[model samples]
Target: MNERPSRHVIRPSGCPGLLRVVQALDGGICRIKLDGGSIQADQAEAVALVAERFAGGVIEATNRANLQVRGIGPERDALIESLLAAGLGPRNPAGDDVRNLMLSPSAGIDRRMLIDTRPLAEQILTTLQTHERFHELSAKFAVQLDGAEALAMLEHHHDLWLSALVRDGEPWLAFGFAGVPLDEPAGRVPLAQGHALVVAVLELFLDLARPDQNRMRELLAEFSADEFVTLLARRVPLQPCPDWRRVASTDGLHIGIHPQHDDGVFVGAVVPLGRLDAAMLRGAARLAREKGDGSLRFTPWQSLLLPNVRADNAAGVLARLQALGLLVSGDQPLAQLIACTGSSGCAKAMADTKADAHQLAERLHRRGQALNIHLSGCPRSCAAAHIAPATLLAVAPGRYDLYFRDATLPGFGALQAHNLTIEALDHWLDAHPRSPLDA
Candidate 1:
């Protein structure tokens, strides 16, 4: 047998990686960060097999478009070895934690994409993993490369964000920091300089940020964005883009069959509460192999997309996915709900968020309403990277405080009701059917 590459020592962090399994209430968790969430069919099957053999068969599709195996046993090393053999490990061991780049699951295939982000994403990802200096970045420090795809996750804020644009009939990338692409860009760079811009921004951040300031927002709080951008200009050419703003992405495009830029179509399905079993994964992999391209792309919506499918085969693929116990329709109440690993898995949780979300879904479904709601076990908001239209924060077992998303307010928006049970919350929603909170 070939010897495995020696694991490099990484900075201390609470987050899990393929080489670092963090203990949770359920067991250990090992996160497998995919390049733009793309996973080959056979590689996915290997993941399923290892999850069943070494963990509790619980595989979760994270909000960051990554997968994690929960309830791992003492055979953690074996599980890691299996995944590594399947080519899921980082290019370099130390690169694992810093591989926090997000791309639209429909990056290359989206009909509305301005440019194919895969090539640029590849360059950035390689630099992130192989560049030794970048290893000092916080595990949560992330970057987003937007191709202006209709199905992009534009709400999730990142340390740095780049969105493709066209200026004077030439391709350019509008860039910003400490926000999403929807925000007005601080500057623009030529398309060919996208990779250089990313490298310069990261290097500048590392140089200026204090040891205590690990995130871009933290550094910006001390050093103004204008000041940072001024220094960045010295590293790379920057063009003012004061009037440039990214277009809003269409919601629910991540859930049904969507047409690609080419003749092929992509079928998407929601993984209930972001949790999947070994069987569900294996089945999806098989379908990907048979009906679509031999790969699956997970999404920031905690869903998976089977891309490159023939238009005629899209419906059948969707149906097969549904048979695997995945939610293929937006009307499914669970498809609109997201929950964290509550008391059932996380020690910090005050309640079993997953079970409560299920109960809430049933109530909403019976009422013929499918609203986008997030159920968080605690203030950490592990389930959602972006604020949902409505948030239910747990205060005690079966009780939560409801908040409505108000652009004017911060941190889960304005809190509306405090400590209401799942049943009472259902009643509250029923009472306010016409309110914006209905979303």
Candidate 2:
């Protein structure tokens, strides 16, 4: 706690970052941000070692497709040092917090990509970090770059989102403010101008926004999008985009074996409740080095993908990942479950979310059900960036209130049942067997 990243930095947050460690009920949590959710095999092992040695070995694959080390006691400094040694820290110390850029896990390797967004993403990330003026931005003020990858996460909302599009059969990137690619794009720019567009938008945001207007949406709340866009145009050129919508991709692309554009395959797996032990990660790292192309990619679904594996060895690699306690197959009930850190970790938790989620997974598994289910510790659905089809909001230690997703209703959709035990939830789930909450 003494080694604060910045003097102006806010006091102990539940939100973890590389330079800062957020304290929880369990201990301090340190988040390690990956470049496009891609890390080398050795880096994965480093995370495993530090998590197991200095912390509680509870490594979480975050919804942002990053890694978080949870349950750190007084040895926080050592853990941080290990991660830094592994080259996981930000480029500059002051730039650490604002380094929030999300790229598709399959950015360059995906067969359906229009452009490889990695180079542009790198430029943006460097600018976000080194630009001292941008340091004032909130850690949650994220920007997503989509390369039109078939395996992309389009549902997560961000302060600024840029998605690749083809205009007149030429590659262009369409951008929107405070929305996802799935939403209509406000404007478009040539692929070459993508980085400049991001820079202009961010600089304009910093210049015009007040202290209270930390996010783009907040600034847009008072100032019209056109007004903001005009100010942005003063810095860089932007073309008006029509009513083109982003093509939706398949759900559950983060599980099992997947094809890559290159001459190989990538095996994906999920961590139960987004938490994993050192052994599991280390085993994955070994598989990545042995069978894959020595790199692993994490996804926004709180899952891990071992990319660049030979297609011939993919089955064995997946089998190895499964043997290491990873949920490789999509049919597993646990694979469909996403849960936040509950009473065992976060002080605000109403239930032991991990334990309760395990019970739910077991019950649903017995009933042969598989749905996108999110189990929040409390009202804050931190485990998921987007609302899942079904949610169980914890009300007590082991009781929950269930809700189904209804686009018409706000906040986790409409409430279905109140104060139901795990067993009762099982029965309710069984009764609604035909619901896609199972599909």
Candidate 3:
């Protein structure tokens, strides 16, 4: 007989974990963090099954490339057991919350990748989970390892980032603290020392940070990044990384068929509003098993990639995904819009952002315009890790404050309009055709 999954004492946090199901307006939510966003078809099916059997059949593709099962009932332990049986749980119960590492969905497959980050990522992940001290780290404390992939999510800020770079015909990792990979690196280390450097940084952080200082950005607020780097050098050898800036990644690589460095192609499709019904997930898993490599890689854009699909079979896979109601094209207005679980699932939500998003998409499609828009139920901006080009902040039911992302302005950027209905907002967006909202 298979042993029952050991239930661990749930920790106190707003975030959910595989073992820690946080209660939401919809019910309990269990977050399953994938290693490098990759899940086998069998495992994906397991998730689908549990979502249908124990939850309300709602699966979310999170911005970090993880999956969450929402609307879970009292059978939380049974649901956790099912996921743990599928090998989706953390190495240890205590380690679940600390495994907040992000990787490029196209890690080893991207044609533009300079290094295969999988090996290093595995090493870092193993350390993060097995190192008991790391459990002290905050659940939201995240790290990003970029392999110079064209399909990478470079805009999302991380507590620590190591981006692959070539120096003197050798691969090196450009390191930065409390920022995205696009920022100027604080220093560089040999690719081989990448894991050691990460260990050193985390240890240094834990030693220097107070109990209240959980994130690197918070610690940096009190201590200078340069000073911290100066201290880190004594622990890990580092080299100057002056004039090194990560090249801008190509946009929209998360959707549609994209060529891999290898012979096979990757078929990408975005989940409508980051949601997948049980049927949609099972269909995708079946497609992965039949046409692709039998594995699915979720993307930070709330999309999933059927990697290693034959170039010839890519079209068929994409067509099947579209038939399943997934958005396969970036040009579709619905594909460009993202909304958080609003009043339906979140107590903090003032408006039904998802319903509003659907209305906005229809209007934008009618105008033949597709702009990246984020609809937040509140100011927390839980759905998006980075700022979208345009944001609609809900103030009241069916009414929102509009803002366009500005280089200079803070939180949700510069306000453009206040408390406009979806219809009025659509008119404003149509009138400002060439505004940053369009970008």
Candidate 4:
């Protein structure tokens, strides 16, 4: 347990949450964990203001659907206080790291949702923050609560995943460990017991795991999920989810106008390569204040949406989003690419992943290849939570080792190329045009 650096409960983590500003090669990074990726218009504007004033104005929307202000300086504490003042801090000071519950951006309003997950998600988030024991959990430890939303992100794995499903005509949450909702659930619980199940799982993890085993997957590496669930039964009610298949979500639901379960509409837009300038953020905030509900919800796909928009004005909102340089169409190749802060900003980076991704995007656009590509500076793969269809792991200044996603293999799937330039990658991609990676 002393793997923790010091004799303090809230030990400093390398990963920055709202309260912590971690030092990076560029500057201090202050991560703002949004509740289910939703931020009120005023809160968004406050973020814009603080970022511009206290940081270098390089704001990043993380893959997990949160915001981070990069290039922060000596004014880090003031910046943190300003954000906290804006109601962006965790429920408890010690609970900041443990508040890693993720929900679908379209949780309540998605057309295909079987249950409204926001209420349950809110309860879980509150418990994760307010519960003192969970404060010791890793900041990266995360949970996914899915409502069978058509706009859900199924690829990004989580420590624990709970997906809505029907059992004998009643709503139940089919849950799993260290995987996505698409994976077979280890068990199920009634909608009412959802929070208790999460609490039990987290408590069991804390009880059974050493400090090094900060994640559910790490604990699972030594203990089986069956064992964990069996132990969990002693603490909370557990029911086997015999017949549950998480419904497949639509791919393009993260962009353009989408009809909600109700008569309202939602306008979605991609943030070109997951990076947004001050104006882009402020503009989105203004739009959120004006057209739709006065709130914006970011998605794991590195995009955002204005949910509960009036059906009549959805088209106009989409056009305005496009005019502001957000990608309103999913067909755009650049929209599919994700690149981490490369050599330009990160000391660990070899090649510039962001710049390389741009070049790769141009090549793919020319070849009419539609693929989900992730460019990582190092093995950390900071930009992508899951192994993308294609990955360019940087090995040198301008060279990278390419890998294609293979489910059977671990860690970036099957290695394709040793070290290739962007030009060489284009050739390889051109050769394998119809590969499933490109589909």
- Candidate 4 residues lying further than 4 Å off, grouped into runs, are 1-10
Provide the overall lDDT of each model, using Cα atoms, as 2-decimal numbers.
0.92, 0.86, 0.93, 0.86
Q: Which sequence of candidate numbers ranks them by TM-score, best first? A: 3, 1, 2, 4
lDDT of 2 by residue, 98-183 (tens): 78899888889888888899999999999998988888788889999998888999888999999998878888999999989998
List of clashing residue pairs for candidate 3: none
**Candidate 3 lDDT, tens digit per residue, 86-132?**
99998888889988889999999999999999999999999999998
lDDT by residue (tens digit), candidate 1, 114-208: 99999999999999999999999999999999998999999899999999999889999999999999998999999999999999999999999
TM-score of each: 0.97, 0.96, 0.98, 0.95
Instruction: Please write out the lDDT profile of model 4 over residues 9-94, one tens digit for every residue.
Output: 45666787776677778888888999999999999988888889988887788889999898888887778778888899888878
Once model 4 is optimally superposed onto the true structure by TM-score, how far is the C-alpha of residue 363 displaced, in angstroms? 2.5
Model 2 regions lying over 4 Å from their true place: 1-14, 434-439
Q: How do all the candidates rank in terms of lDDT, highest first?
A: 3, 1, 4, 2
| lDDT value, residue 220 of candidate 1 | 91
